[model samples]
Target: MAEKAEDTGVIAWLVETVKTVFWALVIAGIFRTVLFQPFWIPSGSMKDTLLIGDFLFVNKMAYGYSYASCPSIRIARLGVDIGADDFCGFIEDREERFFGADPERGDIVVFRHPVDGRDFIKRLIGVPGDRIQMQDGLLYINDAPVQVAPVGTFDEVWERQGPLGNTPSCSNGPVGPGSICQKERFIETLPNGVSHAILNVGDRPGDNTGVFTVPEGQFFFMGDNRDNSVDSRFLQANRGVGFVERKDIVGRADRVMFSSAGRSMFAFWTWRSDRFFKALD
Candidate 1:
């Protein structure tokens, strides 16, 4: 009788364990299939905007369901009915939920890289049907030059490697100073609505020429750190970063949750006290 009772207790514990595991799996599946996800900043592609150690929350719902899993594929039949399957992903979704009414100009968007499908974040510069060009290190959107007003001082506001005048992105033209990162700044505007800041690091052979067209359902993006960035210019030169699909946008940078800088070995741990609670443009 004693042995039987012990065996019964062990069986009950096993049953409870299985139930707990099942529920956990179900909850995880729901979260992954819906709601928001997280992404870490791995590189300096959008240097001045997103830093290397910053951790961000990606709003998957911002653009609706993008990665639905299934085995079936849709293929067009040739003059007769037939089971369809092909290398191209053309299966019609049973249910569709549209997200993001439209991507705003200058909106910082996170997207799947067209070249390799890795997630990338960049600001929208050109939209469908717009012609873009670069002139004398300055950007020209649809024949109108962008306006960049001098706002305080980037060097004073942000902690670069050196003093206010020595930012690498500022070392050319009217402000060109080898002694400092002398370059000009501007506020750029794109057609169909978007405006943002641009940092020109001056006369790098890479920034002087290019005429681009933005196709429907695609956008042209670039980083603010002009000379220091690998953006639509480089992406298009290689013909890889040409167009970012609308469905790829993750979400806008709503706010700057935190910022830390200076000469501390643990820069993250050394928080910028005043800069805390500051909003991102």
Candidate 2:
């Protein structure tokens, strides 16, 4: 009888352990899908605003949930004619809740790759019904030069930009040393007086040329690391696709939660002490 009681206790303990782990994962998934998700900037595509190795928290509910994913919005279960959703471009959801809003320009955002389902972070440079063109190292939005200027203090980093479709070095960024973190970077000005800094490495792609028109439900994105970033400019070869879909947007970047180095990713003990707690713009 004693042995039986002990065996029963052990089984109950295992059952409780499994239940705890299952619930923990369920709660984490809910938070990642519904509330906020944590992300780390792996490259300089976002430059000054976001840097490689910079980790941030993205708001998932800024828009709403999408039926295209999760059990709630399953097409087979919820059908196509759903109600309000937190997902972008969804325009509707399940419980009959409704809200109408769209992402605006100059907003830093995270979206799903058009080609792949992976998430990416970028700035909203072009919107629906906008004509964007580039000529003579200038950005023209609606046939006007987008205001950009080089500042003494630049957030760009110079890097080894390889050959890019006959376009030579355009992004002149930096191969920054110990200060690989985002906040250590400086600023740059776009042609339109939108004074923002992007990472510029002395690569060859800043000279990329193409005219893009953002579609109704899509948005155009570019890396702040003008020279080194492979954004909409390099879409033809990007696995994530050139344009971002509305459904991929997870949240708007509010501020930098923390920053570290590219190496800090491996040996966290090597994190630069001075690069901590610097407020993001």
Candidate 3:
């Protein structure tokens, strides 16, 4: 009889353990899928505004819910990929958002690529019916040049950045490793009076662009790093991100939760204390 009691107790403990794990997973899935999603800055395209290795949580509720609100999980190192559409693909065909609202100009937004399902984040530059152009590295919106003032030069160590080990380009070219790489920085004020810092790394083809009229229901985005970004200035071919659709927007990035300058976040010594909980413009 004692032996039988022991077996029943063991079975009860196992069932309780399984139930606890199941509930934990269910809550976490809802939290990630409906509340906040974490993102890490993987490139220097946004430059002074957002750096590589910067980690932040995207506020999915900012513009209400859409098919893109469903998280697309992809961990390249782990070989895991579950597309956002895999969760909410059925509603995507309807092309409507649940409690949807439009994102404002100058907002830093994360959206899924219309062609590929990968996520990309950039400053929202133009909205529907707005004409955007770049003339001699200066931004022109609706035939008016936006206000841009030179603030200073943004300098950083000319070393490999992030896990990709990509090197930074300098206005003063070809600097040695551990040396300072400089990029001209400017403060640009949009029509709505939203101002942010932008970096210029000499001239490139993106410096001069013909006027692009943002299509209806679509939005335009651009990186803060002028010469290095493959944003709306490029067409959506060959892995370029063109104009993004409203339904494709995932969320707005409001703050940097944490940041590390090193390749791995676990390198505690490399944590950027200044950027912890840093708010975005």
Candidate 4:
């Protein structure tokens, strides 16, 4: 009788623990699906504005949650690639819940890469029906030149040693040692009165692009690191992310929750304390 009682008690405790864990996961899933999702910056394309190692929370409700907005596990269970171009089936049939607003020009958005379906974050430069062009590194929207004010020069050199292979040199980066790269920085103010810093590495091919008309229900995005980014200026056929459809956008990046300058998360000395909780313009 004593043995049976002990076994019963143990089973009861196990059952209770399982129930607690299950409920916790459920609550977490709900929070992640309805509120915000975390993302880490992996590239320097948005340099100076958003840096590599910057971790931010994307506000999913900023532009509403579509079918692609479902949590990854749920999406996986559905047996579909949520990042695919046709994940939402049809552009006209895309469904969103709690639709509160639309993304504005100058907003940094996280969206599915139009070609490969990878998640990418960039500043929304053109809305539907907007004409965008870059000439000699100057940006023009609807034939009006956007204001570009010189900020200063950005110089940095860094080394990356990790599982991905050792990168001994980096340009305009936070890495340590080696060849230092200098780039001109400028403040670009959009027509909507939103201003942010942009890096210019002289003139590149992207600096002289033909006029691009944003189609209905599509948006043009660009990286702050003008010369280095492969954004809407290039075509998808050329391995560049072209115009992103509205249904592909995941959310808006509102702020930097945390940032690190070191190679490892455990490196306390490399923490960028000043960038913590920094709001994106």
Candidate that scores best on lDDT = 3
lDDT of 1: 0.56
TM-score of 3: 0.97
Better of 2 and 4 by TM-score: 4
Q: Which residue pairs come into collision in candidate 4?
A: 158-175, 158-176, 159-176
Name the lDDT value of residue 41 in candidate 3: 97
Task: Rank by lDDT, highest first.
Answer: 3, 4, 2, 1
> Please, what are the lDDT tens digits per residue for candidate 4 over residues 57-170?
989988986754554421455676544334434442463334746799999999877666677899999999999999899999999999999977876664553223234223
lDDT of 1 by residue, 41-79 (tens): 445455556654455555555556444211112233544
For model 2, give the 10-residue run with minimal summed lDDT. Answer: 160-169
Q: Estimate the lDDT of model 2.
A: 0.57
Query: Considering summed lDDT, which 10 consecutive residues are worst modelled in model 4?
Result: 161-170
For 1-281, candidate 2 gives per-residue lDDT tens digits of: 99999999999999999999999989987776667777777665665566566777776556564532332232435455321233433442232212424666767777655544456787777777777765654566777777665554443233422112111123332225423222223353444445566544432544646778888776777766665566665664644357665654556676676776534555566454554554554
Per-candidate TM equals 0.67, 0.71, 0.97, 0.87
TM-score of predicted structure 2: 0.71
TM-score of the candidate numbered 4?
0.87
Question: Relative to the unseen true structure, what is the C-alpha lDDT of residue 18 in candidate 3, on a scale of 0 to 100?
Answer: 100
Q: What number of clashing residue pairs does each candidate have, in the order they appear? A: 12, 35, 0, 3
Off by over 4 Å in 1: 1-29, 68-100, 156-195, 236-240, 258-268, 271-279
Model 2 stretches with alpha carbons more than 4 Å out: 67-100, 153-194, 202-208, 237-240, 262-266, 272-279
Top candidate when judged by TM-score against the true structure: 3
Model 1, residue 172: C-alpha shift (Å): 9.3
Cα error, candidate 2, residue 212 (Å)? 1.9
